[model samples]
Target: MDYDIAIVGGGPIGLAFARSLAGFGLKLAIIERQPLAALARPDYDGREIALSQRSVRILDDLGVRHLLPPGGVASLAAAHVLNGGAKRALVLDPARRRRELGKMVSNQDLRRALFEGVAGQDGLDWLVERDVEGIAFEPASAALSLNDGRTLRTPLVVAADGRLSQTRQAFGLGAEMNALGRSMLVVKVAHEHDHGQIATEWFDHGQTLALLPLQPRQSSFVLTLGDREIRELCALPPAALAAELERRSKRRWGSITLLSEPFRYPLVTTFAHRFVAPRAALIGDAAVGMHPVTAHGFNLGIQGQATLARQLAESARRGSDLGDLRPLRRYEQRHRLLCRPVFEATNHIVSLYTDERPHARALRGALLGLGARTRLPRTMIGTMLA
Candidate 1:
């Protein structure tokens, strides 16, 4: 098989890339190791992605925004950060930043929406349950060998396969993986409080807990803790775990109960040393995997996909080689510039709040107080949503 671009990984990032290039007169194929039905399932477990205004705008442009299930996307009008056990809260109104601060949607729903959008468009092909065994790149085209003894060729190959990208390894791309000695326990809970479209985060000395408002009478709870602590919590029965969460959160929502099984993910920062190699380019987590503390991982992926599509489209308009090193370099440059600062900031914030030193605690409290008083910092955060 031949195509203008071969995208490895049928996740939201790959699907978004396909949708972005729908009308560009380019043939694109997405290869995935999982069946389409598996991705479309409503019960798939993953963190809910908080889409920024910029991300929503890009999705709207691709005409997939409405495909999100009814009530699947929750508008967050306000965000509150609490310190010292919710004794002090700093509230920031995201609505003041833009028409809508952002929207929270299940990862499965978002992926299904993108897949449907791409599947309905022309010049897009889906290859599921197919794994790439190896990649051989040349100036004219790149050849990808599948485990099933089939070979696919394309002028450009996008390595959106994820942080552990096999394509990246085939091309000898090096990356730095910083493993934070922490994991996140995420679960949905039924609550009596209205929550009023408010997203709340509570930062204690060693852990940070977040309650993200979902549709009527529900919210997603994300608890970050050390590995040992997580294991202990996981060993507890469901009711016990709910009790612990309620105590940790200081019963802010009156009382809490688990609505689903708890899911845990190790916290890590994956930094791909390069974003492009010869006839291939990287997008999404394949390029940069961020800490979840800032909720920038998926949003960054969307932005990277959009930036790559726009750069390639411009190259095509000028009759330039789409896989040319120059065009790919431009994409890498812009994406790195946009992602690096957020990655660093998130890491720094995590370290500051999770430290155990008394001095660090005092510093964290002072910083939070200062952030509350400063209009400039608040404005900058507001602009980030925009």
Candidate 2:
């Protein structure tokens, strides 16, 4: 085999996984379509990742945490979930002695940190500006054909390509993909009033709005609406767009001014029917693409990669076959147990909150009220956030 293992993505999750295998003396390959320079210093893509404590610990273990910019990390002290036209909100506060629910970091910053940690590592090949055109899996190894007419053989191949992973498709793995008919627009904004380091999610009549606290006077504004509506908002000039945002938010944070270019994404959630196939296994978005409603996408990706890395490292230490099904099955079962519940619950939440029927609205308000009055539910949510 040309390599012991081959990872088919170079995003944060893939990079972190590669870094985890460092010092194991395994010949690894990271095949990425993105250029090397972009991997080193990724541009901001207007998405902020809410990382869990477990995820932070994983990054720390990988030696990537310290590489993040100090100012780029924001504390999520509390979260408020509000229903349509309701003054009351279901508040999730930090547990006793805990200062924050989680840490919020820009996507680009995390990517850069992971890339920095993985680059120049021993016994690893960083193949940039390349695409995996085909894969031929054998009982003993897999042959990965590059777009440039080169084939690399590996005992195990990991698919972290993304939600729309072509590698997973090539492996004949089916996924349950739900394309929600809404789009999300994210922008950096400066507001007059303080956000109090609180993240607020509002489910109004026909839209969803979230304000994630970043700096003292700045926050990330996330608005979800119909595709045409989002396009219209994106088409507006800066001043007009800011005014529209201020109006839509009901001036909750007082006046708002746009501070950065807006970015929009169509909301889609996906889950593979299986996490592994033969000599190939899936990780990151390729395994489970989560809805951002609960802000678990990035965190779950980190957890999946870490879980797979641990299993693979153990296999290497035992001098076992790198493509052994034993370790791969364990990784799949554990990751599936960790992901399935969250993925289903998030989809349910999105369904319930986004339903605009009268009965649905009433039920939503009742659920929110019940959650606010119940300490157990709030505590559980807070614990989950922490």
Candidate 3:
């Protein structure tokens, strides 16, 4: 076999998985369509990732946390969730002696750090600037045919490709995908007032907005709207855009100025029916693409990849084949147990918050009130961050 395991996609989750497998004495390869330079120096795409404590510990173990750019990771001191135009908000704060709920980092920086951490790992090869044209699955091994006419045979193949993973489809795995007819516009803005390291999410009538604190006066302003509305908003000039944000936010953060280019993404969430098939396994977005509303996408991806790596390591220690179904099934069951609840709950939240019906508006407002008064909702969110 050309390698013991081959990973498709070199995104953060994929790279982190490879890095975690270092020193395991298993030959590995990371196949990415992007060139080496792109992975080495990723461009900011206006997306910030909320890192749970477990994710931070995993990155620390993989040696990618230290590679992050200075001042890039931000502390999420607190979070406030508001409903409609109501003044009452549900506040979530860290427990005693805990300085932060979690950390925030840009997706670009995390990817770059993972790429750097995986460099110089022994028995690992990078198959970059190439696409996997086909895969032939056999009982003993899986053979991947690249666009460059190179065939790689490995005992196991892990797919970390995006939600619409062609490899997952090729493996005959099915996924339940929800393509919400909404797009989220993300932009970094410099506000006149201090954010106090607090993040705010507002599920106002007809729209959803989140202000993620970064540094002191900077924050990531995320606005979700219909597809057409978002496109029109993106076409506005910088000054007009900032003004519109101020108006939408009711000048809560005082004045806002655009600090970076706006990035828009159509909302989509997916969950695979199975995370394993024959000698194949799916990780990252391939296994589950989460709605960014709960900010669990990459966090869950990191957890899933780490779980798979542990299973593989244990199997290897037992001198079992890397592609053994017994271990792959264990990874599948464990990851699914962790992913399904989050995926379902996030989708339900998006549904309730975006419905805009009179009943939904009333119910959500009541829920926010309940959350503010009760510890259940606050505790749930705190646990998610931890």
Looking at candidate 3, the ten consecutive residues that score lowest on lDDT are 377-386
* Candidate 1 least-lDDT 10 residues: 91-100
List TM-scores for all candidates, in order: 0.95, 0.98, 0.98
lDDT of each residue in 1-386, candidate 2, tens digit only? 89999999998888988998999989999999999999998999999888877788888899999999999899888899999899998998777767788888999999999998988999999889999999998889999999989999999999988999999999899999988888999999999999998999999988999999998979999999999899989989999999999999999999999989999999888999999988989999999999897898888888888888899899999999989888898999999998999999898888999999999999999999998888876577666655
lDDT (CA) for every model shown? Answer: 0.84, 0.91, 0.91
Candidate 1 backbone collisions, by pair: none
lDDT of 1 by residue, 1-386 (tens): 38888999988898899888888888888899998787566355757888888898999999999999977889877777876553667767654526556898988789889877887678887788899999988878899999879899888899898887888888788888898888999988877677888888878756789988888779999999988898788788989999999888778787788888888888878989999988889999989999887788999999999999998899877877777888899999999999898988988987787777889888888888887887755576677767
Supply the TM-score for candidate 1. 0.95
Candidate 2 at 249: error in angstroms?
Answer: 0.2
For residues 73-138, write the lDDT of model 3, one tens digit per residue.
Answer: 999888888888899889988765577888989999999899889888999999999999999999
Q: In model 3, which runs have C-alpha deviations exceeding 4 angstroms?
A: none
In model 1, the runs with Cα more than 4 Å from the true position are 95-99
